[model samples]
Target: MGFNNWNSTHCRAEFNESMVKGIADTFVAQGLKDAGYTYVNIDDCWALPDRNASGDLVPDPARFPHGIKAVADYVHSKGLKFGLYSSAGTKTCDVQGFPGGLGHERQDAELWASWGVDYLKYDNCNNTGADAKQRYKAMGDALAAATRATGRPILYSICEWGSNQPWTWAQGVGNSWRTTGDISDNWSSMISIAHQNQSLAPYAGPGAWNDPDMLEVGNGGMTDTEYRTHFSLWSQMAAPLLIGSDLRTASPATLAILKNTEVIAVDQDPLGRQGTVVSDSGGLVVMSKPLADGGRSVTLTNETSSTRTVSTTVKDIGIGGASSYALKDLWSKATSTTTGAIGAPVPAHGTVMFRVTPGSPVPPPTGVNQLSDLPWTSAVGGWGPVERDRSNGEQAAGDGRPLTIGGVRYAKGLGTHAPSDIAYYLGGGCSALRVDVGVDDEAPNTGSVRFQIWRDGTLAADSGVRTAADPPVRLNADLKGATKLRLVVTDGGDGITYDHADWADARLACGSGPSAGTHELSDLAWESATNGWGPVEKDLSNAEQAAGDGTPLTINGTVYAKGLGTHAPSSVAYYLGGTCTSLTTRVGVDDEVTTKGSVDFQIWRDGTLAAESGTLTSADAAKALTADLTGALEVRLVVTDAGDGIDYDHADWAGPRLVCG
Candidate 1:
């Protein structure tokens, strides 16, 4: 729905005849149409800056040769619906280009109706804060009155970004309205949006829905596990299923998530009821929705940085009528039955969504006990911000750590001394809590702090008074029968001067957690990502094929790694290990049927290309290569996108190895 170089770089959506046709072609081929994801909507920046002499919005001459009607016809020919974009203001969001339909709402609506447009995504931008409801209603009225035999009624979508709280008042004004800001291809953005939408649960239903922006499933910013959570949450919220990435070159994981029928069914449920949170703890949240078939869709989310096991009983999820339920894992497509409590092992930034049907209840599964990462989302209560970098009494805590751990601030009382209390949730499964308590090495230490674990206001363990230099006092506490955990800090001898505190590496220990992944690159830190190249994926089996021909990428006489795509001429970077002498991997495009996607692998050490490989194409000629990383602190691999974007571009580094010195 977004096109790059159109009017904005938003969504990286590039508008062109080939790209548009490519999306349309893949949407049908991928079977997204039958899944209730039929509409192919294009976002802003489609039209030129000025309309024709008759004041009619026209497609860019260079982008659309056959014009808008032809494009609409092409979409219709594929048995799919078409959508377009416009602005409520005088000029659209793209200030540099694209004329807005401010005074020409009726004319623009009539024109789109004539062109057989089935949907319209009206955005609010550059308006200098005009009346949102009135302007949007004007367009909505015009669309309703447009008389076009060829065009079906346009499903109006309002993109006000929740400025006027459209969910509260835009019931009949539009089919769906964005309830939040734009979403990026990352975990924090996705989680933030999900949290924001929790309040608007009552606003979405069958005829109308809450728009949380677009999907970033295939986007490379987050891992597959996180993407699955993103998709599942969006589905649970009944948000629009707009694909924002290139479908033609989607990864296997992305395709699997997009084609999830059980999840999609929840979104398309006839009941049209949005799932609401049944139980919410720090990082653990359980959401449930009553389905049309007397079933329930439950999503147990561990929205944290480390792995955790979130558990809840069937009664807790409000399925009292059913003694037990047949539970199906929507992401894994695995089935199992559960009775009293359903405890699932959820990875960091991951979710375990289950479709529950009435059945005989079964006992809890083994290894159900789980540990937890740091609390990141708002579900985790009792946390605030402290300027750790501020230097007065003690502000010197600097390994140059990111301001937030797992995107959460651990400091409190920046300028004036203010004692604050923060608490973390303790699931019954937790055995103990572990964290480092300290004062900002550089901030003023006018206040002494106390750290204690509390069980319903009863003190279990306490660290009497800790100062900046004596911070990180190790403390152990019994979490058994602990219903709540607290970190209550008090001001020292001075009256609220400067009491910056830190809780570093805060986590809970339970029975079991996620094992160290077998991914070869998980231990290293990701660096830069070019427009074409993304962070290196670990142990991806898809990267083992030749680009043009479907064959394995063999270096010399050995085959290594499974799915590291070196099929494109793109550069990727990673932090070097302490004792790693050399790094080895195989590079070649997967053996698919395509041309111009041949890639070249160039290893760079400290910004210089240290090793090189010739153009490896679908010719099935792949060389197992190794680079001497020696004393290099950082290593970068530059792979060309085959001088093409991602057309048949499948570059992989299967079984990458690190040789210890």
Candidate 2:
């Protein structure tokens, strides 16, 4: 951990020799040096705009009148390290166009080594279209040679802005690689950069790390809550915590956040394992980092504007078999214990971090259960958090509606976007899993997703490709003797646009089948029915005025074997008898009309309008509709013409299903 002047002073007039010396002195005065902050780095504009007659870099006369070596000597005299900035291109990033260390890599390295420089922030600017790896490696090799000649190691920081994925190749070339663009002193900028850097956990470790720009903790652009989140997330990600604010003017709150030794321990841990996302539904995120000890550092972040309860389980964080776990609040220094769950009410733009130590080992629980009712080992989503009994709306948690797939609503299931993986520790107790999977109807007809079930890393079941237009496809996997179960969703050869996928009615049969039952609406007897043009047909589309005259139920060119097909101004009522919990279906103008019809669909629960689909046309895709039927005696499905007359207003309720005890 250290401090950099770029974010605070950035080429300003105040970035002089005295400022550098003051920072080093303040590091000693402010207890920062004792707390592990050593380096005081100078960024761009430190050097003159031109090279000297001997092709050597010259310190700017006004900024560093006594020269760069003098500043380095002062920092070293305080028992602190010094860092300088240069670019891999012809000039630095500043508008002043200062000379860079591109062709003079060896010379610059040797020059900085002689001046007691211990770190180099190599930037990317004005490069002459050369390969990124080659350019960065040149300076890396030069720094290695400088260390050998001077017997002083220099930390190389590559600032390529992730335009080239340095994480794939920067190991052994630089100590850390910039994984994103420059970070502004704002919550949006910091959190967005954190999201970009969170997924590359595998590339970060002891010697090599992912640099998501510098810390903006005390920059005043965000609240203290947001600043804590910034610090906690950076430390959790094992990022180089280079303070970007001016220490001389830093607030006590900023110093407290920066000097939280418990948090610093997570960053400076010997194992250096970067935390990985355990779950991110909506904006409530949970990350877990394994420490050198058997314990873990967990971070629960609230990215929303409102305070929310963010939570996870010890088993989810890769620690289990403990009778109870000790949780040390890294910021508050408060200690608590839990059997397995770790959670807290986090503030807006805030984070709750903990150092968790597992208790004595014990046997895990085992029984037939819904996966949602049980804690998962880990979960990672593409767009939003992996939800329970809700669709992946790609927003904040619980912002999604009921889990509806191709019009079938599931009262119990997982709602996740594509490129998601959710795991559970079965402990060889589960025998099988039965689930209905599909791209959620929320995506309309635009999504294509693949569902997979893995047992102990072996692919047990796979749904080839389920699109938004397809009905729910059921998969039954024999997970007998397997210790782990993983539910995975992929982009199905297509991109992940609008890929809201669902694992509907997922039942884990450890000792028996699911607790509740489900039934298709078309298979149930209706209490009453009325049609505008013909008798309502079962498992078919409305073709003419006669019953059974319609073909298979079809909407937006996608066919379904089960659903109620009728004309506009029609009503179909089912006697739910207060047994069912919810009704889910996709409603649209039947493709039989071929872009020449418009109608409105509505769902009524005992005379109350529960859900509606405003004005759907043959040209539009099917719309997902859901209604709560809990404790209701009857449910109604109604369709009407769009006030333009019932011309070709053939409507279909596609893949309607009801969940009941």
Prediction-by-prediction clash tally: 59, 4
- Please give each candidate's TM-score: 0.53, 0.58
The alpha-carbon deviation from the true structure for residue 164 of candidate 1, after best TM-score superposition, in angstroms, is 0.6
Report clash pairs, candidate 2.
280-385, 281-385, 282-385, 282-397
Off by over 4 Å in 1: 1-14, 147-151, 360-661
What is the model-wide C-alpha lDDT for candidate 2? Answer: 0.86
The TM-score measured for candidate 1 stands at 0.53
Report the Cα lDDT for candidate 1: 0.64
lDDT to native, each model: 0.64, 0.86
Cα-based lDDT at residue 177, candidate 1: 94
Give the alpha carbon lDDT tens digit for every residue of 491-538 in model 2. 887666789999987766553222257878888777679999989999
Best by TM-score: 2
Q: How far in Å is the alpha carbon of 466 misplaced in model 1? A: 58
